[model samples]
Target: MRKMLQVVAISAALGLLHAGPASAQNRVTYKSAKTETSYYQMGVQIAEAMKAGTKGDIIVTLEESQGSTQNVMEVRARGGDYVFTAPPPLVESAQSGSGPFKDKVDPKFTEIRALFPIPSLTMHFVARGDKGINSMADLAGKTVLLGKGTFGATEGEKYLKLFGLEGKVKLADAELSNAVGALKNGQIDAFVTAGSWPAPNVIEAAASTGVTVISLTDAQVKETGREKLTIPAGTYAGQKAPIQTTSLPVVAYATTAMKDDVAYALTKTFWQQKAAMSSGAAWWNGVDQSLMPAITGKIHPGALRYYKEAGFKLNPSQM
Candidate 1:
């Protein structure tokens, strides 16, 4: 009896020694935009869908942050699994080492990997007619408000720099809601903001006072190397022509620490369920894989793997 018990104990010990490590659970925390905005809502919907679809292998949750710069900062500091951002801010941050990082390029800047891109928001630069702001050239020596956790501010600054208006203009920082009142009150000369067609604040300010939506000339667009968009006719109260300006792509990003399989599964799940996602938020519209990489910088190897396996052609830069 003692010999039999000893043999069974030894056998159990051997089995324990040979057993592979248990599958590590994947907990994905998505840092999204502010709570009241559509961006945040989209993140919530995606999180819920992924959580439901991933079964038990992955745990997904959503939280809100200030905007692009803050989201990027959080992703690095917290080691978050995913974050939502636009190409302009990311590009600007990497190039200037400004924005949230201010004076220094974040050490984790390279860890930012573009997963996929969604539809973009059009940037609108509105100036009170009395402010003497007429064209991009007129912005020199004026105060312009740019962005609110959005790319308009960062990209707008780039445009100013390109046009030789960097030191000439006062770049004021204010939220979109407050911008309308600020412009009406003459607190600032011009404001830069981005969003879908007919940004509500622009319309509201226009109704109360004469406001002009500054469009970027073609030459200016070419110099920035960013995507161009047109605010179509009848988009605003008095807009008569299609104003040409630049737009930024809203994209998903993952860190370098994320595994290829996890990024693959997450990317696959997003596309597979995007059809349903669009039904909830119109911003999810036009999430075509083909055009996403056009502006979004480098695609993560893990996400690139999924895109390639799914039969998508990626430009050399994205690869």
Candidate 2:
């Protein structure tokens, strides 16, 4: 009986030793764009970084999102373990109960806190180069797909109206995921997509079918009131010149429901792994401490703790 008792105790101790790390693991759900989008790819990259950076202490699961608005809406039901990506403007809209969030406003929106900036949402108006579509005006009378429920779609529509192509251009009903395939088949003349450049879909479209990224003129860019961004020459397969466009800054965020320590660890892991992540994905190269000011809303206390420790200066609003 004494020997049997000793064996049982030993087995119990071994089991706990193996289970300790597993029990302490923190699981977080990271919501980004559709699986087919670059944002989703970035989520996968971030998840890998989080797991490795934390030595498996933190596990991140990627959730396919419909749009930024949808990502923000889920905050009402999500707890601290929920992490999402969205533009600063959308978060502001949610906080003020304006724009698409007007009818679905919740106080939980106020709980959203910034973590880190990813990549800016740079606009791409891609059209088949063989179709003689060289400029925004050329989009008139062409069938275009501006993906529904996304910032890209909204911006595309606004540009269509701004450039006087609204009633002239035919809008496709197909999903944006199908846009590249449709364009390659000559079924759609052009498509508007927003992602960090060298966007995968745009790359595929340009490489397979030869696409032209429409550039906005100085006057046109100024009229739109969006910050001007230039997609340098050779960004795509056939592109030979720079394309002027606008961009929306995007950031990672969590709610106040998350523990401070978890947030701090995540923030720290991101900065530490950023250089490594950038090596794999060129889009990550665009992110840096300079863009920290673009992160909207108050920073999560845990994330703030990491930032301060790293000696990053914070604006008053971030506090």
Candidate 3:
């Protein structure tokens, strides 16, 4: 009886040890910027899907980092297996390696991969119609609140520089909600945010207080190489006419260096179960097969494999 009991105990210990390594190999870590709502939510959906499809063999661990800059850095350092990032920043990082990560890393630190393009994030420079802040050019010498530590701040800075208004504008970073409140309370002259239509905070604030959405002129759009975007009439609670706007492209990526097979499996599962991703977040409502290419970057080998298998002809030049 004693010998039989020892054998059972030893077998159980070995099984537990083997399970640990197996679990570790299948697990992936993801880092995202807390300020990006859609990216954060997408991460949740992907993680859940991965867990479900892999029968828990694959586990996704997520942590909120500073922003795109930090997310890329963490991925490069192998601190995480995947990251969510915007296109401009991702391009800037991979091409120049000089902005947020200047002097600390090489340009090739990241292997750019395509995930999906988010709907364009329209730039809204909100101010009281009575404040006399009518256009981007008029932002000169004005106190402005740029959405705090978010992609909006990055876009605001980019546009300000393009229009030679950087030095003329006094910019401060404020959380989206706080910036809206400040604008409503007359504490700030204007608040700049870049987001898809009906950003809840902006809509709620605009509804509560009469706010003007500034439009970028054609000349401004051409000069900045920005896309001419519009917030359709009635997008906001009270706004009537379509709000003419302009925006730089905002794209997101599921960047990972995992084996192509692993990446392929995940991407395939994600596309097959797209509806599952939309269950909790409206943001995923826009993630259809048609919108995939707008995400600029090299598709992960795994994703590429799946795409090819699906009868999609991918041009090498496009990559």
Choose the strongest candidate by TM-score: 2
Expressed as tens digits, the lDDT of each residue in 1-319 for candidate 2 is 9999999999999999999865698999999998977889999999999999999899999999988888999999999899999999889999999988878889899999999999999999999989998889888899999988777898999999998987999999988999999999989999999889878899999889998999999998998887687888988998889999988889999999999999999999999999999999988877888788887579999999999999998899889
List the global CA lDDT of all models: 0.73, 0.91, 0.68
- Once fitted onto the true fold, the runs of candidate 3 whose alpha carbons sit more than 4 angstroms away are 1-25, 35-38, 49-58, 88-92, 106-110, 118-121, 129-143, 147-150, 157-177, 248-256, 273-279, 286-294, 310-315
The estimated TM-scores of all candidates read: 0.65, 0.86, 0.72
Residues 76-167, candidate 1: write the lDDT tens digits: 57664665565545655764676556675766777777777755766788999777676888888777787554566666777778889878
RMSD of 1: 7.1
> What's the candidate order when arranged by decreasing lDDT?
2, 1, 3
Q: List the residue pairs that clash in candidate 2.
A: none
Candidate 2 deviant stretches above 4 angstroms: 1-23
Query: For each predicted model, how many residue pairs clash, with residues at least 3 apart or on different chains?
Result: 0, 0, 0
Give me the displacement of residue 220 in model 1, in angstroms: 2.7
Clashing pairs in 1: none
Superposed on all Cα atoms, the candidates' RMSDs to the truth, in angstroms, are 7.1, 3.4, 5.1
